[model samples]
Target: MKAILLHGVTAFLLSFSALGQMQSFSLQEVKVTGGAFKNAQDVDLRYILSLNPDKLLAPYLIDAGLPLKAERYGNWESSGLDGHIGGHYLSALAMMYASTGNAELKKRLDYMIDQLAQCQAKNGNGYVGGIPQGKVFWERIYKGDIDGSSFGLNNTWVPLYNIHKLFAGLRDSYEFGGNQQAKQVLIGLGDWFAELIRPLSDDQIQQILRTEHGGMNEAFADLYILTKNQKYLETAQRISHRAILNPLVQKQDKLTGLHANTQIPKVIGFEKIAMLTENAKWSEAARYFWQNVSQTRTVAFGGNSVREHFNPTNDFSSMLKSNQGPETCNSFNMLRLSKALFLDKNDPSYLDFYERTLYNHILSSQHPQKGGFVYFTPIRPNHYRVYSQPETSMWCCVGSGLENHTKYSELIYSHSANDLFVNLFIPSTLHWKEKSIQLTQATEFPYKNQSEFVLKLAKSQAFTLNIRYPKWADDVEVMVNGKLYPTSAQPSNYIGIRRKWKTGDKLSVRFTTSTHLEYLPDGSNWAAFVHGPIVLAAKTSTADLVGLFADDSRMGHETKGKLYPIDKAYMLIGDTDTYISKVKSVGNLKFSLDSLTLQPFYEVHDARYQMYFQTFTQNEFDAQKAKQRQQETEALAMEARTVDKVSCGEQQPEVDHSYKGEKSDAGYDDDGRFWRNTRSYMSYQLQNKGFAGKTLEISFSGNLKTEEVGFFLNDRAAEIIAVKDRVISVKTDNTELITLKIVSENGRPTPRFHQIRLMK
Candidate 1:
C-alpha cells in the first residue's frame, strides 16, 4: 500500500491483520435508495441545513478575536459547551455530503472549514476552539494549574471533551469530505494541543482526564495515523486514563458508577490504539468491555445507562423509573465503538448489536416528519421524549443526532481483500469502485422478512459474498437466480457464497422473525417486546408532554411531563409461558397485547409510550400492586415536597447543581448507591424556586460523625433539626437560591453524602 502524505508527513501503516479485516465502505460509496432510513436521512439533512453555520461559528470566531457573522446559539452552545455543535455540524455536513451527495451540505462544510482555517490563522499557535476563555484555559493547563472534577476542570464544563468534538470533526471532514484545508487545520490544532499538555506530568494529565474528555485518545491516535508522528501516538497513550484502562485490562467491571458516554469514547480510543499498535491486552480489554456493557447494561433497545450514569447491573429500578432514560448520545458512541470493533475483529456479533441499536435507538431518535432530534428515550411508563428545535436547542444529543441518520449507509456493505460482506439489510446501493461492482440491496426489513440483491458488474468476477445470518432470524433462506442455494450456516455467523457475478444477476435472502418477550438484563420482572432486531413499544397516551419541542432552557432536553404511577402502567398478566403466544400479530412488525397495540418502537413517537412492562402472575398481582403503590406514594410525596434535589457523585446532577469541592472523592458503593465525601469542603447551589422549602435533608450512606461535619446554608451556619435513618435534617429559610456547604471540621473527613434535598 502507498503511504499518503498528510500535512507534510507520511501516514502510519496499520497492522496487516487490522488492514485485512472487514473494510467498511465510505459513506460516499453507498447510497440509501428508499426506506424509513432514507426518510430519516432526508429529515436529518433538513435539520442540518436549518442551522446557520455563522451562528454556530460565532464561538470560534469570538475565541479567535475575530468579527462574528451571527450570534451564538443558546442552550448548550451559549452555555459552557460552546462550539460543540459546530464541530458535530462539520461532521454531519461531511458525512451527509458523502451519503447523499448533497451540494448544499458540501458547500456548508467547505465554508465552515474556510472559516475555521481563518480562525486557526488568527490564533497563530494552531489553536482554534469555542471553549469559554480558550486561550486562558490552555495557559492554565500549560502552567500545571489544573483543578478537575468528573464533569468540570478549572471551573469550566468539559473543555477537553468539548474540544475533542472539533478534533473528530476535522478528522471526518478530511476523511469523508476530502477537504485538505480541514486536514491542515486539524494538524495545527493537534500540534497546539500536544504542546499545551507537554509540560504537565502524567499525574496532572490524569487529573485533567478525570473530567469528561470525549475520545481525546482517539483523536490523537487518528492524528498519529494521519502524520505518522510517534509523539502524537505517545500523547494518545499518555492521556488514556489509567484508572479506567487498568481495570478494563484486568478484566474488571469497575464501570458501574462511571459516566456512560465518557467511558465509551475512551474505550473506542483504546480499541483504535490497540488495533494500530497490535496490543493484545488492550484489545482484549476493549472486547471485554463490549461484552460486559452490551450483555449486562444495555436495554432491549441497545441504549445503556440511566440519568447519564451506569446504574448497578443487577438493579434497573432507577432506570425504569427516572424520566432521564438511556441517552441518545450513549447509543451514538456505542455504535461508533461497535463499528470500530467489527471492522478490527471482523466479528459478526458486533454487527448484530450495531443493527439492533441502529434501528431502535439511533433511528428512533429523530422526529420522522418535523425534522428534530431526541435527547432521551425514557422507559418510564407514560413518559415522552423532547425533540430539539434547530434554532433553540444545542445539546450533545442534538450534535450526535445530526450525524446519526446521515450515515445509515456506513455498514450496509463491507469488504476484505477478496470478499464482500452484506452486514445490514438496509435498502441501499453500494459501488465497489475497485472491482467495478454495483450491488443494490432492496428490503423492507423488520417489516418484510425478505431482501433481494441485484448486482451490476463491468465483467464476470468471482468473489465470496458473505451474508449475515442474524441471531434472531430463523429458517433463513438464500436464493440465486430463483434457485435455492444450499448452505449450512449457524446464527450469528456469515454464509459466504463465492461465484462469478455478472450484470443483471440477482441474489435473494429470506428469514422468519418471531415475537418474544425480552426481560431486562438485570433479570428483573420488567420486560420488553422484541420482534427480531426491532423493539416494540405501545403508545400509552398523548397528554402532559410538557416539553415535546425543547426550548433553550438548560434542562429542556429532558421530558418534564408527569410520570405516571408504575402500578398503573400496562402490565403483562398471567403466565410468563403464554406471554409470547398472547402477542397476536396485527400488522407488519406489530402486535396486539391485551387492549394495547404494539408497533416498532421507531414508529411509536409523538406521544407517551411504554417500552418495558412489568410482569406479574395472577397470584402475585394484588400484592405487587400494593407494594408498588406504597413505594410510588412515598417517592412521589418526597418529589412533591422537594423544591430541589441533587444526586451526589453523578455527573449531570452535580454539574447541574454547580457542585464544587476541595479534596473530594465520590464513587458507587456495594449497596448500589452513589456517594460523595470531602476531606476539606464541598458545596452545591440548589434552586429553591418556590420558596416553599422549610427544611434541608441530606441523605448519607452510613452513620455521620456530626461533630466533625459542619453544615452551612446561604453562607450562614445551619441549625440541625434531627439525624435519623442516616438522613440529616436542617432548618432552612425561604431562600430562593440556597448555597449549601458541607465542611469537614478540624481536618476530619465528612461523611459519605448520597443526596441533598430542599423540602417543604
Candidate 2:
C-alpha cells in the first residue's frame, strides 16, 4: 500500500533488489541508428564541426604561457567569464564521440585533453583554469580572504562557476570521450582545489557556497564515485549548503526569489551524494525538490522560473507577461535531475514530466532548419525569442544547447539484473550483452501511436520484459507474435511479459491517444492541448522577429522585436469543449482550428506559435473579452513610451547595456521581476537615441526602505533624494545619450531597483 499510494503504480513493477541494483547501459551497448534522434544528432555534429577549436583553446594557452593560435570569442569569451565555452566544447565533443563514434570528434576530444594537460603541467601546483589571474584569485580564497556574492568571488566573475566547467569537461572526457589522460588531469585538479580549501572552516565554505558554483558538489561527488575515496566524499558533503538542502529534506517550498540554475545544480549534487553514500535523507531532499518543481511550479511548456529566477508559485502573471521567460539551461538541468531521480526510484511521475519537457521544451528549443539554439521561450501572448550562432553567441544556453541534441537516447530504455524497461517511444535498439539478447524498437510514435519490437537471440532465453504503459495513453493494446496477449492491465504502470523467447520473436504495442485540454498549474484561464505526449501549438505570425537569427552582439540572445498588443491576440472563439472538438486534424502532424493552424511544437520553427490559449467559460466569454480590451489598451500605451530598457539579474541585457558596478547584488522579487542594487554604486548606459524621451523612469519595488540616493548622468551627480514610489520619474534634458547611475553616500545599500526605461 505504501508503494502504490506514495509512488505511481509502476513502483512494484520490479523486485526490490532489482530496483536498487539496476544501472544504465553504457553508451556503446545501446546505439540509436534511426529515428528523429538520429537526424538531430546529424545536425549537432555539423554544428560541432563549425566551431573553431583554436579559438576555444585560446584562454588555456594564454594562461599556460603558450602562444594563442586563434582569437578568443567576443561576447562572453572576451568578457570576464572567459574559457567557459572551452569546457562545454570538450563535453560536447566527448558525448558526440561516444554516441556517434565519430572519428573527427574523437580526435578533437583528444586534442583538447592534451592541451589541458599541458596547461596543468605548466601551472606547477596541479591547478589549471582559464580564468584570468585565477591562480591569484584562488590564493586569496585559500588564505580565508574571500569576498563573495551571487555572481562574483574575490573581485572575479564567478571563478568557481567557471572552473566547474573544466571539472565537467574532464569528467565527461574520461566517461564519454574514453580518454585516460583526462582522468589524471581531473583528479589532479580536484586534489589541488581540495588542498586550497582544506584550511577553510565549514562556515567559510558555506559562505563561499552563497555564490553560484556550478555543481561543484556534484563534481566532487562524481570524483568520489570515480576514486572510491572518502576524502572527496567528505568534501562533497561539507560543501552541500544546509540552508537549501535541509528545508528540502523536510519537504518545504522555499524556492521563491532564488537563482533558478544555481540551485538546480546543487540539488543534482545532493542526489549524486545520496546515491554514492546510500544516504536516504539526501535522496528524499532531491525527490522532494523534483516534485515541488515539476508539479506545482512548472508551466504548460514543462518549464519553470521567469527571468532565470523562480517566482512565487501562487502567481504566474509574470511568467505570462515577461519577455524573458523560462530559460533553456534551467530545463537542461531539470532533465539531468529528473534522470537521476527516475533511475533511483523508477517512478512513472518522473518519466511523465521528462517526456513532456523533452517533447515540448527541449525538442522545440532548436531551430529545425536554421540549426540555432534558443535562450528564452517567452510565453507572452505575442512575443518571440532569439537564437545563438556558432561564432557569435556564446551564452550559457549555447553551452547546454550543444549537449542537448547529441544525446536524445539518454532515457529511452533501462535494464535490471535480468529485466528490461521501455520508458520512452523513441525508436532505437538495445543490445543486452550479458544475456546475448538484441532488441530493436521501431516506431513513428505520437504520429502513428504504435511501436513494434523484435528480439534477436541466439538461444532460447527466459526473462521478464516490462513495457511502460504511459499515462497519456488511454488504453494500451499489446500483441505477441500477431496474437492478442490478453491482460487486464491499465495505464500509469508497466506490463511485464515473462516467458521463454526465441530468436526472431516479435511483439507490438499500440496506444490509443485522446485529445484533452491541460490548464496551467495555477488554474489560470490559459490552456494547452495535449494529444498523447505531444504538445500542440498554433502558429501565430512571422512578423517582427528581431534577432530571430542572432548576431555577434552581446544582447543578441534577447528578442527585442516589437510586441503585439495583448488585446488584439486571437482568443478561443468558443467554450473549452468546443475548442478541443473543433481542432480538426489536417494532413501530416497538423490541425485546423478556426483561423489557426495547429501542429507539433517541435516541428513549428521559424514562426511565432501559441502553446497556451486563452480559455473562458461559455457564459463569461463576452465579459472576459471586454475586460481584456481595456487592460490591453493600458498595456499598449505603457509599452509604446519605452525607448530603451535594462532588466537586472539577466545576462544579455546587463552585458549589452554596459553594466558596471561595485558591491552590487541581484535577485528576483516575488512578482518575478529581477532587481540589482548596490552599496557603492551601479550604472547602465541607456541610448537616448534622437533625444526623443522627456523623462527617465527608474523602477523599484514598493515598500523597500532605502537610504538617500544620488543619481548620475554621464558622470555628473545630482542632489540626493529619497523616493517612495514604485516608479520615480526624472526630467532629462539630454541631447544625445546618458549613463544612469544610482548610489548612496551614507554607506547604506540602495533600494532594490527593478528596471530602467526612457519614457515620453
Candidate 3:
C-alpha cells in the first residue's frame, strides 16, 4: 500500500510542475544597455525622471497656483482643456520616472498628488481638474445634446480625456516605475470614476461616450491591474466603444473611416482584458485587428492613408494627392500596439514592421539639425514638409514626438527565460538578468547588412540565442565560433540556435540584398521602387514654390508651364535588363539616384520627387522609350531657346501656361487669360473657350505671393500661388477651354503682371 501511494504522489508532483510551466505570466527581465535609450551621464536618470514630476507636474502645479490653484486651460467660461493630453503627460512622466529613479521627479510627483488630493477635497467629490466647465459638459453629455456645434459645453470630453492621460500615467508609474503612491492616486481616481458612472444606466453611459473621447477603457483596465479590483475591470469592459469594439470583435472592416489612433487605445484595453480574464475570443479579436492593419493596410513607410481616412483597400493610387495622410501620432500608437502584440505572440513579423517604421518614418520624422518634428511626411509630388516649432507648435505630433525618441531601448532585446531574442539590429547591449549574461550587439545595419554579437559572462551560462533575419534579406549567413551554420527560417523570421554559450562567444551575420516591386491594390499598374527594405524615390531640384502661387519672374520663358514626362525628369541611365542593376550601386546598402544623384527617399530634403511609377513591359518600353527620348530632346531644345533668346530680350517674355478655372463668377479673357490689378484688388473672370479640334495651352505670368494664386476653371479650383521651381501642367479633353483665374485670399493684387498667352 505504501509503495502504490508513493507512485501516485510522484505522478501528481510531476503534473503540478508541468502546469506551473504552462501558466507562467511574469514578463522576462530583459535589460537594455545601449541603443537610443542609453544614458550619457549619471544625471541622465534625473533628466528622465524630470520628464514626469519636474516637467509634467510643474505645468499642473503652476496651473493650480497657491492654495487650491490649478493652471487654467483657458477660461473655465470658454476654453476647456481636455484630459487626453494631461493623461499622456502624466502617464509619460510616471513611466519615465519609474524607468529611471530620480528623486526630483518623485518629489514633483508627490507634490502634485498632494495638490490633487486637496482639489478633490475642495470639490467635495472625486472631481479634480483645473477646468470647472467639465461639470457643465458632463451634464450636457448626460442630456444627449453633444454635436460640437456650440462652444461652451461642446468642449467637455477634453478634460476627461486629459484626466485619462493622467490616470494612465499614474498606472504606468506604479507598474513599471515602482511608485506605490502612484498606485494610490490611481485607485482614488478609479473610485471617483466609479461613483460618477454608477448613477447612469448602460444606455445613458453609451450616449455620453459618443463624443470623440480617447481611450477611457485603457485607463480603467490599468486601474484594475493596480488595485486588482473587479469593479475597475467591469468599468473597462463597459467603456469599450461599441462602434469600434463590435466591428473589431465581429471580424469586420468597419475601420475604413474611423479615427486611426483614437480606436487603438480601446483595442489595447481589450487586449489587457483578454489577458486578465483568459478570454480566448477577445485575444483572437485583438490579434486579428492588429494583423489586418499592420500587414494589409500599412504603406512601405509603415504608415497608411492619403487623407487621415483609410482609402479603399488596394487603391493606393490616390495616396500622394493629400496633405493630411499618416498623422505622426497614429504611427506612435500603432507602434505601441505592435509592441503589445509582440509580447503576446513572440512573433518576428511584428518586429519587421516595427523596424521599418522606426527607420523610414519615425526616425526621419524628426529634423536632425533642430530636433523638431515634421507635421506630415508629404508624398505629394511637389509638396514640401511643414515642421513644428519648438515652443509654439504643440500639435498632436508634438505630443508623440516627445515620447518617440525616448523608447528605442524597449525593443532591442526580449527573452523567454531560457532563450534570448535579438530583435532589432540597432547598436545596443543587453543584460539578461535571469542568466546573468550580457550580450553586446554592434551594427550599422540596414546601411551595412552585418551585425556582430559579443557575449560577456560573470559565470558561463548555457542558453539558446534567437536572432531575427529581416524579410528584406535574401542571402543571409550566420557563423558561430568560426564555424558556418545553415539556417532554415526565411527572412522576417527568427533563426533560433540553442547552445551552451560560454564567455567570449561571438556570433556574426551577413545579409544580402534583392530588388522587389510592390503593386498597388488598384489595377492602375503603379509600382513602388524598393531595394531590399529601402524605398527609393527620384530626386528633383529643390524649387522655392510658394504655398499656392506661381512666380512671374520667368515670364515668356519657354521653360515655364512645360510638363516634362516623368521618364525625362528621372532619366533611366542604368541597365534596365536587371532591375537590381538599375538601382545605382553605392558601397554598402546605400544607393544614389540616377536622375539627380541624390540620396534615398528617406534622406532627401527640400526636393520635388516621385517614389511610385507606372512600369511598362519590354515590348511597350521599346515603343515608348523613343517617345521619351524625343520628349527629352524637345525639353532640352526649349531650354536652350529660352536661354539664348529670352536671356537678353527687352519685352516681358511670353511663356505658354494653362490653368483650369472654377465654376464661380471668376471671369477669364477670350483666350482664357486672367489678370490681377497691382493697385486695387480685382478678381479675374473666366470664359470657356470651346475646344475646336486640338488641345490648347493657356499661359499667364504674375508676380504675387504663392499663397495668392487661385485659378478656377471647369468647376475646379487650382491654387498656383506656391508654384516653386516647377511649372504647373495639367492634361484635359480639348472640348473644354479651361478658364484661368488667380485670386488672393487677402484681396491683394499681384506686384507685377507681364502677359497672358494661349496657344494650340
Query: Comparing 1 and 2 by TM-score, which wins?
Result: 1
Q: Model 1 off-target regions past 4 Å?
A: 1-20, 702-708, 745-748
- Tell me each candidate's TM-score: 0.95, 0.94, 0.69
- Residue 739 accuracy (lDDT) in model 1: 91
Predicted model with the maximum TM-score = 1
- lDDT, candidate 2, residue 657? 77
Task: Compose the digit string of candidate 1's lDDT tens values, residues 1-760.
Answer: 3333322222222323433578889888899998999999999988998999999999999999999989898888987899999999999999999888879888999999999999999999999999989899989999999878788788789999999999999999999998999999999999999999988999999999999999999999999999999999999999999999999999999988788999999999999999989999998899999999999999999999999999889999999989899999999999998999888887788988999999999989999999889888888888889999998999899999999998999899999987788889988999999899999999988789999999999998887677888999976887877877655677877766667678998889999888888899899899999999889999989999898999887778887777788878888888889888888888777788888899999998789999998888998897888888999988888777878789998888887787888878888888877889988899998887778888889999755877889999988999999999999999987778899999999776677999999888
State which candidate has the highest lDDT: 1
Better of 1 and 2 by lDDT: 1
Off by over 4 Å in 3: 1-84, 94-124, 130-132, 139-160, 521-523, 537-541, 545-580, 598-602, 605-609, 616-760
For candidate 1, list the clashing residue pairs, or say none.
none
Task: In model 3, state the lDDT of residue 308.
Answer: 47
Model 2 lDDT per residue over 596-660, tens place:
88788778777776777777675777777778778878877788898778887664466567777
Global lDDT scores for all candidate models: 0.88, 0.81, 0.54
